[model samples]
Target: MVNYASGEAKGELSGAEYRRYSRHLLLPGFTPESQRKLRSAKVAVVGAGGLGSPILQYLAAAGVGSLTVIDADLVDSSNLQRQVIHSEAAVGTPKVASAAHAVHALNQAVHVREVPEVLTPANALATLAGHDLVLDGTDNFPTRYLVSDACEILNVPLIWGSILAFDGQVAVFFGDEGRGVTYRDVHPRPPEPGEVPSCSEAGVLGPLVGVIGSTMAMEALKVLTGLGSPLYGRIQLYSALTGDWTRLDVARRAGRAPVTEIEDLVETCGFPAVEASGAAPVRAEVLSPAEALREAATGRLLIDIREESEAAEGMLPHAVNIPKTQLMEFARGERAGVGPLSEVGDLHGAILHCAGGARSAAAQAELAALGISVANMAGGYVASVTLRP
Candidate 1:
C-alpha cells in the first residue's frame, strides 16, 4: 500500500545525496528524488542466519540508508555454507557485529547498527519503531511471533521468509497496508506441537537461503520505494527438488484476536505453549562413527542434520539424511506418520550427527524441543571415520 503523503514536497536534495545514490538516480524513471527516498529508508532485521544473509547483503548493496541487525548467535564454521554474511575470520565473532561489519564492507555510506541480543517483547518496540521496514529472518516461532506482533502493533510492514528442508515461504505482512494479512493469516496456529523443526534441528541449503533472502530484499525495496508489486497479502513458495514456484493470495483471518502488543500475540497464539524459554535444556549425546555404527545396527535412526550438499558427501550406513532446511517440513510430512518413533514414529532410539558437534548438538536440542528423543554424536561426522594406514 503506497502511503505517500499528499499536498506536495519533492524538494531538491543535497550534493552528498546525489553522490551517494547517483547510481540509483541514473536508472530510468528513478530520479534523484527517488534515490533520496531510498537513501532515507531504514530497515531492521531479526536474526542474521540463512535468510538474513542475502537480505542484509542486498539491502546494503542497494544503499538502504541504515541497517540494524539483531542476533545473539556467534558464527560457526558450519554456517559458512549458508549464512554467507560472515566469513572465516568472523567464525568466533558475534553474529550481529559480524553482520553489521559485513554490511559496512558492502557500502561504507550505509549506517549499520548491531543489536547483539535475542529479540524480546520489552525491546521489540524500540527495535522496530522508527524503521520503515522490519525483516523476519528469525528461526523459531517464539521470536518470529515477537517480530510479527510488534510490527502489527506499530503498524509497519514485515518482510518474512522461512526455509524448511527444501521448501520456503516469502510473504509481506502489513497491518497498516489496506486490509492486509499478518503472519497469522498464512499459518494461523504454529505447526503441530512436534511438527515444526528448526534450522539447527534440520540443515539448510546454503544457496537456497540466498534465493529466498535476496527476493525478500527485493520485496523490501518494492515496499520501501513503491517501485513494484508488493508481497503483502501474498505468499510465494519455492521448492528446490521440483524447481516449482507457487503464489497464494491471502486475506485476514475472521474473528481473530486483535493484535496490540507482543504480549497479546503470545497469549493469542498460545505460543510458548510448552514453555521452551524456561524449560531446562536437554543434554546431547555424542558418539564416534564407530560407536554410531554399533547403535545404527539396533534399528536406531541416525539423523544427519547437515546442509543438503554436505550430507550428500557421505553419511552413516543407515542414516536418514534429511538436511536441516527440510526438517520442519519433514516432521509434518508422511514420514512423521510412518517413520521411526524418534522421528515420524515412536522410535525406541535415535542418533543425531552433523559435520561438527555444534550443528548436530543444535539439531539435537531443537528436535528434543519437538519431543524427539535422541543421542547427539559428540564428535560429529568427522569422528565417525575409520582409522587409515
Candidate 2:
C-alpha cells in the first residue's frame, strides 16, 4: 500500500521527478512526501473530452503513478474548442490515444493506459478497478450514475464534474454504506430524457470547461494526497456568466437505500425505448439526407429539433428552428403558438432533425404519440450537409 502521509513509497520519485516537481515539493501543505504519494497513486479518468482534458493534463503533470484514460469517442473538429488535450491534427483519432499522447508529452515519468472502449454497466467494475480514485467527466446521465455506482461498489472516491453552457458543477462522493453520500443522494432520479440538452446540443463555452475541469483535478489531488477536506459530501456550483461560486452541503438520504449493485441504467434512466437487441431498427420512412434536401428544395417543411444555439452553428438550409423541447410541448398541445408547429397547420408528415439523429428520433416518437407522423432526417444535419449530393 502507498503511504500518502510521507509520499515515500516503493515507487519513490527519481532525481528527474524531484526536479520536475520541485514546486509541489515546496508547497507548505503538499510536501515532498505528498508528491511521492502522488507518484504512487493510480487514477482512472473516464471520458477524454472537455473536462477530462484538463483533469488528465493536470493529473499526469502532477506525476500520478499511473493514469488510465477511458473514452470511446474519436476526436472531432468541434472537440478542439474545449477538449484541449487533443490537437487539430488529432481530430479523427481515438480520444484515449490523443489523451495518452498529451499525458506522455506532459510527463514521461507517469504511466498512461488508454482504454478506447465505452464504459458500460457490464464492464464498469473491470474497467474502474485497481484505481485509487475515479474522475468522471462524462457528459451523459447514464454514465455518471454508472461511475458513481461503480465507485460505491469498489469503495473508491469519485471526483465528478459537469459543465454545460456557462454553468458547471463539481462534487466528491466517498465512503461506504452509512457514512458517505453517493450521487443518488444528490439527484435521486435522473432527469427526464431530453429534459436537459447535452453540451453538444446546447453548446458550452470553451473556457467554462477549463475552469471546472481544473477544479475537478484540484479535488482529485486533494483526495489522493489527503491535502484537505476533499469536496466529499459537498457540491460546488460555478457560473461563468456571473463569475460566482457556491457550495452546498450534501448528505446521504435518510431512508434511501445504498447502491448495492449496478442496474440497467438505460431503462432506469428513462431513455427512449429501443430494440431488445440494442440496435435501433432503421425506420424505412426516414429520409436520406439527399432525399430530405430534395424535399426541402421543393418547399417541404424540415424542422430542426436541435436547440436554437446548436442550430445557429449551421443547420440544414430551409429548416425551421423548433427546438426539441418546444416541439415536444407543441406536440402535446400544451404550448400553442410557440414553434413552427403553428405554421405546419397539421403536424402530420413534418420532417425533423437535430445535430445527430437521436433527438430527431425522439421528436418523431413524441409527435407519433400525438397521432402525428413525421419523417426523421437520417443522420440529422451532420450527414445531411456532409453527404450533400
Candidate 3:
C-alpha cells in the first residue's frame, strides 16, 4: 500500500511546529502521520501571478517541505492588485525570484526553488518529473494544456485554478492517474482566435483573485497529505458578487480521447482555428501589431496583461489591467469596473499583449470562451511598444 504518511508518525513535529500546526494535527484526518507526508512531499507551482500568490503563501505557511516555482515574467505595478506574493518594493524583480523570497519569508523551513524561465513544452515533462503533485497556477491555455499533458504523461495530479473579474474555478485533474482526465478533457480545444478578452481589455476585481487562489492552495494541501476527499475530476466554480460556488462534475471518457485538438497544438500551442465540444468560439476583430500602432483606432480593445508595476513602467494608452493568468475566469465572469458590461461587451474584438507573446496569446483563447473575438499582439507588448514607440 502507498502510505500517505512518510513513516514518521510518532514524533514528526517538534514542540514549536506542533504548536504552529496544533489545530492541523488535531483535525480528524490530519494526524502527525499526515503532517509528515506534507513534510516529505514536494510541489511545483507553474506561475506566480494572481493565482500563484495564494497557492504559494499558504502552502509555505502550512509547511509544505519544498516548493518549486517557475515563471518567466517580471513583477510590475499592475500585478499588485491580485498577485499577493510580491510587494511594491519587489515590483521590478523577476516573478520567480520575488516569489521564492516571499515563500522563504513566510517560513524558512519550507524550501522554495525559483525557475525564472517560462515553462515551455520542451522542458515541461522534465520540469514536472519529480514533484509529488504540481499546482496549475499558469495564466494561459498553451501553458495550461502543456502542464496538463505533461502531468498526465508523468502520472502526477494537477491542482488547477483560473480566475477573472468576479468568478473563478478550481479542480483536481488527473489525480487518480489511471482513471482521471486532464484540462484537455474538460475544455478540449484552445478556442478560435479573437474569441475572448484579455485582462487588459477588461478590468478585474482585486479580491476575487484572493478567494480563488487561496482555495487552490487549500486544494493542494488536501491532495498532498491525504487530508480529505480531493476535488478530483470535479470543478469547483466561484462567483464573488453573488458569493455562489458551484461544482461541475467531470469524468473520463469511456475510451476515446477527451480532446480533438490535441494533435494540432503539439507544435506551437497557438491555433488560429479551434473547434471544441463545449461551445462555439467568439470571433475577434483585430489589427496586426503594426496596423494597431499606425492607425491607433482599430476599435480593438488593446489589453496589456502585464502587472501594474510593469504597466507604470509603460503601457498602451487604452490598455487595461487584467493579467493573462486571470484571462479564462475573467472572460467568463468579469464585469467592467467603470462601466456596464453586457453580452455584446463580451463579444468585442481585442489585441492581447504581455511582455512578449506567451501570456497574451493564451489569454486571447480564454476570452474566446466568453464570446469575444481576440488576437495576440504579434510581437507581444514589447512588439506593440516598439511599433508605437
Instruction: Highest lDDT: give the candidate number.
Output: 2
CA RMSD (A), model 1 = 9.9
lDDT, candidate 1, equals 0.72
**Clashing residue pair totals per candidate (backbone < 3 A):** 22, 3, 24
Q: Quick one: best TM-score, which candidate?
A: 2
| Model 3 worst lDDT run, 10 consecutive residues | 1-10
Candidate 1 residue-wise lDDT at 381:
71
Candidate 2 has a TM-score of 0.79
Deviation (Å) of 70 in candidate 3:
0.6
Candidate 3: lDDT of 3? 11
Q: Best to worst by lDDT, what's the order? A: 2, 1, 3
Runs with alpha carbons beyond 4 Å of true place in candidate 2? 1-11, 268-270, 274-304, 307-352, 356-365, 371-389
Task: Please list the C-alpha lDDT of all candidates, in the order they appear.
Answer: 0.72, 0.80, 0.71
The Cα error of candidate 2 at residue 233, in Å, is 0.8
TM-score of each: 0.67, 0.79, 0.70
Q: Candidate 3 overall Cα lDDT vs. reference?
A: 0.71
Cα displacement (angstroms), candidate 3, residue 10, comes to 11
In candidate 1, what are the lDDT values of residues 61-116, reduced to their tens digit?
77677778888777877778899888999877788878877877777767777788
